[model samples]
Target chain A: MIRSEQIEPCAAAEHSGAWARRHVLDIEDFSVPEIELVMQTTSAMKEILSRPLKKVPALRGKTVVTLFYEASTRTRGSFEMAAKHLSADVVNMTAQASSVTKGESLINTLNTIEAIGADIIIMRHPLSGAHYCAAPHVKANLVNAGDGWHAHPTQALLDLYTILNRKGRIAGLKVVIVGDVKHSRVAHSNIWCLTKMGANVVVCGPPTLLPEGLKTAQLLFPGIGVETNIEKAVKDADVVMELRLQKERMQSGLLPGLRDFIAGYQLDSKRLALTKPDSIVMHPGPVNEDVELAADVLHGGRSVVNDQVTNGVAVRMAILYLLAGSREQ
Target chain B: MPSKVVITSDEMRRSIARMAHEIVERNKSTENLLLVGMRTRGVPLAKRLAANIATFEKIPVTVGALDFTLYRDDLNQRQPSVKGTDIPGTIDGKAVVLVDDVLFTGRSARAAMDALIDLGRPEVIQLAVLVDRGHRELPIRADYVGKNIPSSKDEDVQVKLAETDGMDEVRVASQE
Candidate 1:
């Protein structure tokens, strides 16, 4: 029996009006209450995950298909696990093996999946705004896993869950995102989610690696700080999130060199000392060993990188549960 | 449609005390006994019963809250939110007594059993309900029933507890 020691009788009643969105494309338009509702549902899903029998019949008989146009390991695996844990039938398709290699259009593939009775489609593409093109082509619910540098909402949500689990809150905390912010979908999504939740967000990277319109974008969404100096960005920081630096940036001349980038911006012991004592270290995995973050920091006690992966499944479960059941409203 | 109070606060307390004594008499002692309550009102009732058993037998009993929303049969008809199930420890080889406020359809009791069996094997599983109103759709009968209220199918039996609602009472009203 799956049991919770603290069962709030009015918890379900409180979140009755919390979810109505048919698709989860981005966190830029999510209200605070909606985010809180997702966190609340994630907490409940976490309890289910803790049980010996980590299976729930909430999405039983529902068909969930994961359509990936980009190569992925954690996101695709966790989405598949989340669907399977909820007792849903899952079908996974990759661009390399699927009809995409045969030049089948994205719309035709979506229509084929819909015709095969897919209740939900989770897609990750290499192009930005891929979900917008796919959303209108099918009535099935669409979840954006990661689309170029546009948004990775589930990754941001699990990061938020990890930060909240560690720090107990998101507001009034200094969160410094380190690495190639211009090319990281994780960084973009976290910027929106953290700022919307009242966190003081500061993006730290080399001038060439930072987005071009960041200074002007700050005018639209205030309290977002952009700093080129790593030392100044880590000062009094509460959360230091390291994004994976793509090696292609060096070839593109956006970064001078890997050695220069690491010496200037790597989150090592020296830079970590600048943050608060209780501050946490985070990285959306596939860490580059020593490029963006030190190996010690990635495996240290303060690092919640593994917990973020574990929470990723629960967060996706909550999102799938909410979106699949939204039709009942 | 008119509503009338069927069980008052004082009667609720007395009925709970009697049920506790009956449970102890049937099980012979409170040893290795677990009290699992359905969500909403059954949680407080189980706590109250544990307190009563502790007062009489001087032995504390384990209580758990069971929320079987996922195991419910009406998933396709309506989307019910999950309230979560919480058990303190293992239920293996223990005599479990499932508690609920009112028993009408017997479907919830069946779902609760399915949810319980998924965790572990209990030595013996028994049902204890405060009010066992007639019209059971399944072949399930309570081991200890506080009161049996027989009424028309259109009438609704509402059980409100002070832990949840502002008062403790059982009311019967015509369905609107």
Candidate 2:
């Protein structure tokens, strides 16, 4: 996390066309409208769902394969649901049952799926940007569901979608992302979105994960700041995004224990009390309630978990359609 | 700045009926046929297609209406605000035919497909449209199309079903 405003926004489409492209591997790749477009598209799509029958025909004849090298109930299901609504066939491959145990490389599996005639592949891997390495030979579109700590673009899209959805405007809001920023794809993506939407971004985590450089990524999205204290972070925040703490971090000695992590960084009732009364609280989770956030705060009025899950379909629908439909390859 | 309607009532019914016949003919049988209608006007059109297909092939059509409001990519632009999806049924390993009243820019269609995956996997999915007013923002096309009307960027194409609008029609309303 080096602080520098020296970098330039990637050239036109590289910056803008992310609104319509191949894979969503990171947050920095998208622009405001691109993110907003997905939200708007989902809104119209939701309108269609309000009726008696819920189905759409834009993806007829399309086949979307969701390959999760990791385990995810929310995102995988969200993408699956989005595909089904549009009348597209879906194939899911998660690690709970996969050929990886049988000794196949990520690239090999992706290429094999492409050969089998999948029109789109939505992948979630533990390695960062593993989707990029698989991009070359994947004859169909490649959608990165989650790749290591790199990103879960669709997750961020949904988070942004949920925020914009509840509030109508993302600009000028104060957003604070608490917890493990070092390893959270959710935090990384939300930082980009909240800041890009003109909200002030503050990343609060213990020093090691917080790092010195994140304060700089803030400038890219702009209006962002850094904080070491949990109290300071959520104080003026219009949105508080809390992330899960991987127990692995404790074993790796990132910290002593879940209790230690909670004492230092968790959004317990005391910390939650600091946020604006109407500010929204969001988590991309199977939450470790006591570990990263207190139970009461999570179940409180500010929590938008259900909305985030529901909006996940709309956001992924936007990502899948945008990436899968932009096929000239 | 808002969208307005085009096309007439009788024309909408004819287009839907025509699309129903085309879908039935291409699939060779209506046995595994499931009609998934895009939301708003598409839902009524799908019901109409089910009725028309039942008339044509002399069999019942499984009709399911789909709403893409939550799944659409253009939520903020909508005046009334969009809501989350609540689709019914299990689409796993079935031949599904998605029906929409109109096809323009293809963004709405793309979102609908993403929304589909949550329910279950489908064996075969095909798109049937009453109108194809082209200016595709993304690479998408309809399989069974009733009309291929040329449209300008500023023009809005609307399809009204008899149930909602009390008549069936397709119209092209241009921005003044």
Candidate 3:
């Protein structure tokens, strides 16, 4: 249970501005104030999670439909839990289980979900910009879980929340993201979110795994450092984030070999020693043990991967609460 | 809109001191007693009541803050941002006095009761308000009321506490 002294009414008063956006497509569309507002709301949701009775009646009559075209454990499960915690009815659908198997078009499938009276549609499609394509056709608010390698706004927000929870601040912190930067939607969204909040973000990966527009991205997100050297990237860092290495990338010849990648980028205890003493390690999970992150480092004291999962539910709850509330305002 | 001050700062303080005495007398003792204040102005008023009780009883009472934004019945019509509920300890078998600044329509009091029940099974629950303006839609009444100002449905009764509004006063103004 939360202490009565920790609950501050003035904190809620600071975010009196009404939420403006309807759909959460990407981190690029979010302003600084909007991101801060989400963080503040997530703090309140976290307090609810601490209670013995974890349910609330805020979204009593609303329905949430989660449509996933890709495989996800943490994101989908947390979103479902978030909706259930808020007392919103949730319907989960995967590509194999849904009408997508019957060759239903994305827009048509979305309309069908809308017809079922969904107040919010949380979808994870494999195609980039899918939420943008589906947002215009549906009356329900759209939240992109992950679109190809595009963006995962909720994941980014939770990562931000976890970082802020541990460090107590974000500005001027060095956050090094290591692994498949090109294929990881987590990295793409984190870059945008972290940079916007005044963090010095560094992307570390092999030349082939790094994004092609690295130079141009630096221009867009100022103070972003691209380092191929893993040791140099983690040096004196505040936060070291490890992106899961997708095994499919190896078949495409993007990497030399698994052993070679592990030798260079695996975040073992030795590699973790290079960062600041109080620095935290994060991984957007389904982590490949001993490949991207070593077993010891994964279970290390500095690891906040579990906290990230818990914060994911809170962040999603905040997103659903804000989006649903904005419709009436 | 024309408004007139109903209760001055001194009157508000005296009313809180009286309410504290009444709470102590009715409950027989402050043992296992909790003062849970509704969000915003109610929080400070609860603290003030607890402070007064501590002055006379020589034992401090536990104070908590309850935010019922999530338990609202009109959620589908409008959703307010959640401030959060924080109880210092378990409410099971404890006498809870819910403190608020004003009682209007009694809907918020109803919501607060529902919220409290969800947390734990309190031995008993009582409502306390600094002002009780008439026009209640629900069959709820405050156990401890500082003042009763009967007003029409179109009028608004506002309670400004020094902790929130930087002043202590109760005023009634007509809705424009």
The per-residue C-alpha lDDT of model 3 at residue A288 equals 87
Query: For candidate 2, what is the DockQ?
Result: 0.06
Clashing pairs in 3: none
- Candidate 1, residue B154: Cα displacement in angstroms equals 3.4
Kindly report which residue stretches of model 1 are placed more than 4 angstroms away from their true locations once superposed: A1-13
- Can you write out model 1's per-residue Cα lDDT over A236-316, one digit (the tens) per residue? 999999999999999999988999999999999889999999999999988999788898888887788899999999899
Here the TM-score of candidate 1's chain B is 0.97
Ranking by TM-score: 3, 1, 2
**lDDT winner among the candidates?**
3
Global CA lDDT of candidate 2, please?
Answer: 0.73
Docking class of 1: acceptable
How close is chain B to the truth by TM-score, in each candidate?
A: 0.97, 0.86, 0.98
CAPRI verdict (incorrect, acceptable, medium, high) for model 3: medium
lDDT of 2 at A184: 87
lDDT of 3 at A231: 96
Give the per-residue lDDT digits (tens) of candidate 1, residues B1-176.
Answer: 68999999999999999999999999997998999999868889899999999999999999998878777877766555566778888889999999999989899999999888877899999999999888989999999888888878899889999988989999999977
